[model samples]
Target chain A: SQTIHQWPATLVQPVGSPLSLECTVEGTSNPNLYWYRQAAGRGLQLLFYSVGIGQISSEVPQNLSASRPQDRQFILSSKKLLLSDSGFYLCAWTGGYNSPLHFGNGTRLTVT
Target chain B: TQLLEQSPQFLSIQEGENLTVYCNSSSVFSSLQWYRQEPGEGPVLLVTVVTGGEVKKLKRLTFQFGDARKDSSLHITAAQPGDTGLYLCAGAFYNQGGKLIFGQGTELSVKP
Candidate 1:
């Protein structure tokens, strides 16, 4: 069975502070990874996605960036956080095209 | 950018009631999927409809892909409180390698 993990489950960051969120998947290799953010009661906004290590595509140009350091390890980072950056961030992985995505628990980031 | 539009952003119904959520798009997709997400958790794959006009059933939930492969719908029969969650529809464009464009999502609340 495949499983995804993300942490910290919740985060509180001061404005302009650096931020980092990590996601790891087990039981799969070379899977595509994605980063998404959701505002309260709103739809998900795709931030970035990676096909392989060191390859990332940004859907929205913002303060956040993503990196695939390993086959199953993905990281979302920001040099400085903005108030608008506060939201629930999700990490997802899929085996290939048209495949179902499996998601992690998600990180609730609060930028005050 | 390809966009998916979901209808009835929020739905609240009593247990044993029936309800339907829709996902519409102008562009054709190779595949479409439905997911359900609970509060504080990542979305879980409910079903995947690949072929146009395809229909899949899981327990009390039925999913249908449009004949044109541009839309889909999920129907719940005699919904239960455990069925309450956010419903999302995502589509994979042809040759897109499963990079999904997500809909705004429909929040469904089934009360006992």
Candidate 2:
């Protein structure tokens, strides 16, 4: 079965610090990967999605960016974090356009 | 912009009670999906309804897609405490790759 792994499970960083969150999928190759952020137990905001390596579509232009270094490895990064950047970050993968998304456990980022 | 709206942003009900959550959209979609997420975890895909007016049941939970393919609903019969979670609805458009537009989400709490 396919599974997604994301880390660190929880993060606490001071404002203006650099951030890196990684996600990788196992049991699947060239799967579509997505990064989402949820604020205060509400809906999720799409950050970025990648169809293939080096190809990323950003939904909301903000302090964050995404990269697909390998087929199954995706990374979300930021040069400088803002207080508003803190949220529950989720990584998801899907086999195709119509397939249901499988998500990782998520990372709770707290920017103080 | 394509958007999804979910009703009853927060639901608190007792175990054994029946509740229904709705997701509505003005724009049509190729498919609709429902997900459930626990605290600090990524959303888990619960069900996907493709065809118009499609109805699918998972254990005590029932999902229905609107005839217009622009809306969907999830009904839980005799809800249990384990069923408490944040429920989200996502819609996918044809040709949008694997990107999904999510709703604001419905937070359900079933008290035992």
Candidate 3:
């Protein structure tokens, strides 16, 4: 069975600080990886998705960026955090077209 | 931009009642997927509908895809408190490498 791991589970950072969130998939190779953000209790917003190493497609233009260093390793980074950047972050992976997505537990980031 | 609109952003219902949620879009999708998420956790895949006019049932839940492949609906019978969570619908385009575009999501609260 394939599983996704994301960390830190919870984060608290001051404004204008740098941020780094990592996601990894096990039991799968060259899987498509995605990053999403959710508001209070509502829908998810697509942040970035990677098809392969060094290939990233950003959905929304914001203060965040994504990178795929390894086949199953994805990272979400921010040079300086904004108040609006705080939310619930999720990492997901899928095998291919028409496949179900598998998600990680998520990270709750609070920017104060 | 290709977008999905989900109806009734929030729903509160009593136990044993029935409810339906809808997802609509003008752009055609090759496939659509439904997901359920609990508080403090990532969303989990419930079902995927690929063929137009296709219907699938999982226990008390029934999902239907429109004939045009641009819409879908989920109906739940005898709602339970365990069903209280966030429901999301996502659409996948053929050329996006199965990248999914998510709707705003529906928050369902079933009171026991």
TM-scores for all candidates? 0.97, 0.97, 0.98
Positional deviation of A72 in candidate 1, in angstroms? Answer: 1.3
Residues B3-94 of candidate 1: C-alpha lDDT, one tens digit per residue: 99999999999999999999998889899989888888888889989998999999999999999999899999999999989999989998
Per-prediction DockQ: 0.81, 0.87, 0.89
Put down candidate 1 lDDT per residue, A9-112, tens digits, no spaces. Answer: 99999999999999999998899999999999567898999999999999998999999989999999999999999999999999988888889999999999
lDDT of 3 by residue, B1-112 (tens): 7899998899999999999999999988999999999999999999999999999999999999999999999999999999999999999987666899899999999999
Model 3's alpha-carbon lDDT is 0.95
| Span of 10 residues, lowest total lDDT, candidate 3 chain B | B93-102
DockQ of 3: 0.89
| Local accuracy by lDDT, each model | 0.92, 0.93, 0.95
- lDDT tens per residue, model 3, A25-99: 999899999999999978899999999999999999999999999999999999999999999999999998888
Q: Candidate 2 regions off by >4 Å?
A: none
User: Under the 3 Å rule for N, CA and C atoms, how many clashes does model 1 have?
Assistant: 0
Which candidate tops DockQ?
A: 3
Clash list (residue pairs), candidate 1: none
**Which candidate number has the best lDDT?**
3
